[model samples]
Each structure stands twice: as structure tokens, then as C-alpha cells.
Target: MIRAALTSNVQVKVLPGPSAVTTALLLSGLPTDRFCFEGFPPRTKGARSNWFKDLATEERTIIFFEAPHRITESLEDAQTAFGSDRDAAVCREMSKHYEEVVRGSISELIDWAKSKDILGEITVVVEGFNPGTRQFSVEDLVKLVIKQEEAGESRKEAIAQVAKANKVSKRVVFDAMVAHKSGDKI
Candidate 1:
């Protein structure tokens, strides 16, 4: 019924709200030059995990919406996929009487969410991947490959897995592994 009431002559504009994307961006202090709004993430754990994995290497600031009930679980998934130390902000009840914005590492936010009875609409803003600041060491890659191997992945499969997780080429992982074997610095 609301859709039918609109016409080409209508110059409708979205009402300004505190929890809106623009407001969230302002609160986050993240880069605004490039961004991607993902809306709501998948509800299921498996699907949501996969979605987060796909976005792990995104270079643009990411935005998403979540309900109060699911905020904790969503933050948990985000922590797992983006790492506990990744910077993020959780904005709650924007434009409302009790508007709040919490900013910190993903793990800290998760801890905060667990202790509070969150209410009202929620908006999440996450910092994008910055390669220069967070490069994984060769030993780190080896540990990742070994972890994957322990989980039933073959050597070749483990290399591929680590490469994908680190957003690097498989060849790079292989080269690192070989360097480690020969006692050469990567």
C-alpha cells in the first residue's frame, strides 16, 4: 500500500536518523573514500561464517545491520572471521533517547555485547584490511597450514587454505613453506 502511494512526481528523501549509515560512518572515524554496505548478514552460522570469510580481505570499510537479539552471535562470528584484534564499532538505538556507540576491537565489543541487554536497531562498522600494518609472518603461515593439516587437510590443501585465509597467492604460501624448510628468511 505504501508503494502504491508513491509516484514519479514524489521527491521522497530518506529521513535523517542517528543509526543511519552516514551517522555510523561519522561515529566510526573509518575511511569514507571507499565503502561497501552489506546490509544484514546471513542468519545461519555456517552461511554467516562463509560470508565473513569472503569479506575478510575487503579493502573498503564495511557496514551492516543486525537485530538486537542476534548482535552477540553476529559479533562472535565477526571476531572469528576478522580476528579478535580487528577494529570495529557497534552503534545502538541511533536517534533514540538512549543512543549509544561502542568502539573497540572485535573481541572487546563481543565481551561488551555479552554483558549488556542490547536493544533497538544496531549498525556495525568495521575497518578494512590494511596489508602494511597486519602482515602475517612466515611462521604464522606455517602454523596456519599445520592447523589445517590437523583438521584433515592434505599438505597441498593446507597450503591453499592458508593462502586463502591470508589473502595471498598459493605460490606465496608454498614459497614461505619452502623457505622455512631451508632455514632461509622470508
Candidate 2:
């Protein structure tokens, strides 16, 4: 929003208005800090599936504006991409008299979406990826590094490869290696 700024075409002024994206986000009862708004999801099923797959690993809470007609489809794709247990909220008719919000796991939302015909503008908020839940033990990391090394990669290269593949830092992998050699717990 430009505040009293002049563009190449015309002058613009800022106006106070409630953001449906943020409004829906707040109503969803998810984390407000570090959220991202992704405008309308892809239309085609294949493309939407691919897009959601890529977004599945995002750490920041995600907000998406969607059409009522596509709500069920989007929820299905989301469940497939983010897994059935991911927390999410579907907000309908945001900032209006008939506003409604359904909060639950992705699978539960899918059931609710298919339960009845949906109406009005839709906003979907999904909790960020929880890395803690998908952690790899240091022993696991060391084994991965060893596997890569057995595949003809040097120790440095194997460490780097294992770190990148596991979405961990090189130092973490190095520590794991050291711990393995020292017979110390990670």
C-alpha cells in the first residue's frame, strides 16, 4: 500500500481497511507470528498438487485465499501434500455477518468441506512445517553419511550431501561423525 505516493500512472493514497487474509488468520487460532499470504492456489489439479508439495516444507505459517468452488479440491490436494495430520483452518465469508471458521487437522477439514455446500470467499490457514517432529537421530545421520561415502563420495562431500539431503547443517553432521568416533551420545 503506497502512502501518498505518486506512481508513473497516477497518485495513490492509503486507506484503512481490514485485511481479509490477516483477519482470517487471526480467527483461525494459529500462530500469528511469521505468517505468509499466498494469493489464490493453482487452478489445475496437477499444478496445485505440485505447488503444495513444494510448499509442504515451508516453516512459516501459510495463508491462502481460495474460491468456495475449489475449497474441497484444495483441501484434498493439501491433505495429500502436507499429510492428513497437519493443522489447518478454513475461514468462509470473512469479515461478514455469516463468517464461519472451521479449525482442525487437514483430514478433518476435508470431511467438513465435503459435508455441505460451501459459500462465500474462503481463506485457508495451515500451520508451518514442524521440523522437530521429523528429526533424524545423530546415529541415523552418521549412517546416512556413511552410506553416501560408500557410494564413492569423499568424507567432506558425503557430509555435505547428507546434510543437504536431511535439511541439516554441515556442523551437525560433523558433530555426529565425531560423536560416532568418540563413542559419545549425540
Candidate 3:
């Protein structure tokens, strides 16, 4: 669609404007060298959660677009996938008369969203994965699965949860579990 729009004979002069994502990125003072733009999140809860899980360990700053009606739910899902304390910025009505930018942890953003009537084009900028935190190994993943199972999750559900939380494949977690059970080094 963008290609077609630019190729049309109408002689279009494209000029840059203060989009919410760009403005938010500039305001956040995060590393600008490496960044990613994830246009719009999936509409469904399951799909969206899965997508967020996939991106949970992204090292580059991430940007996303959201509608007013779904912003609350999206924030909730983000809080689950990215954790409640992950840093994020919510930019609403960018460059408009009522432009607002709210920055804080995911949990704080969720609370703010709940207390207001959020109307406008919303853009969310989330801090990328920090590798300095505790890194999970295959053995760690196995232990996590075991803990989830002990906490009442089924074997399959535990594997899935561990895989998603570690940003790895379910097959990886399953293979790790099998290897651990067989007393083999993982």
C-alpha cells in the first residue's frame, strides 16, 4: 500500500511528522542505534500474549500501536509477558492539543490507564531485554518446569509456560525435561 501510494502519478511529497512512537523514543532517552517498530499488536488475547512472549527478550527497544478501547487489555497482557516492573512509555494523542505521555513500569501504566479516559492514537515504547539480569540455562528451564508442575500445572502446560517465559521453544523445554529425567547433562 505504501509503495502504491508513492508510485502514483499524483506527485506526493512525503514529510516527516511527530509520530507518537518517534516522539516517545526521543523523550525516553533510550539507545537509538538499535530499535524496532512492531506496528500493531495482535487483536486476540491468546495471539497477542503469544506475540508478547516471543518479544519478551528482544534486546532492541520496541514500539507498538494500540487503539483506545484495547489499550488497557494490551497493557495488562504486557504486564504479564514483560513483567510488572518493566519500563515503558505510553504516548497518547501525540502532537495534538491534548497530547499526553505517561512513563513508568508496566504495572504503573496499567493503573494510570484504568484511572483515565484514554482517547486518541496510543503508542507504547517498551524497554528491551536487559541481559545483565539472571540468565536461564537449560537446567534452569527444567527446574522451572518442574516447579510449575508442582504448583498444579500439567506437564504440557508447565513446559509451555517455561518455554514462553524463557523466550525459547516448547520443544527445547520438553527436550530439556526429558534429558533431565534421564540423568543426562543438558
Among the numbered candidates, top TM-score falls to 1
Clashing residue pairs in candidate 1 are none
Q: Give a tens-digit lDDT track for model 3, residues 1-186.
A: 422442353322223264656766664445556789998999999889868877888889999999999999999998876778888878777666777767788999999999988898888988898856635566778877887888799999999998777767899889888888898866
C-alpha TM-score for every candidate: 0.72, 0.66, 0.67
Worst 10 residues of 1 by lDDT: 1-10
lDDT of 2: 0.81
Residue 97, model 3: Cα distance from true site in angstroms: 0.8
Relative to the unseen true structure, what is the C-alpha lDDT of residue 104 in candidate 1, on a scale of 0 to 100?
87
Higher-scoring candidate on TM-score, 1 or 2: 1
Candidate 3: RMSD to truth: 10.3
Model 2 TM: 0.66
Q: Stretches of candidate 3 above 4 Å error?
A: 1-18, 134-186
Error of 2 at 119 (Å): 1.0
How much is the lDDT of residue 98 in candidate 2? Answer: 77
- lDDT per residue, candidate 2, 1-186, as tens digits? 221122233432222147877777666667778999989889999889867866877888899988888999999999876778988889887656777778799999999999999999888999998876656677888887887788799999999987775578999999999999999988
- For residue 85, give model 2's deviation from the true position in Å: 1.0
Candidate 1 residue lDDT tens string, 11-122: 2233355449977766665677898899999999988976887788788999999989998998899887678898888987776677787878999999999998998999
**Each model's backbone clash number:** 0, 0, 0
Q: Tell me the spans in candidate 2 whose CA falls farther than 4 Å from its real position.
A: 1-17, 135-186
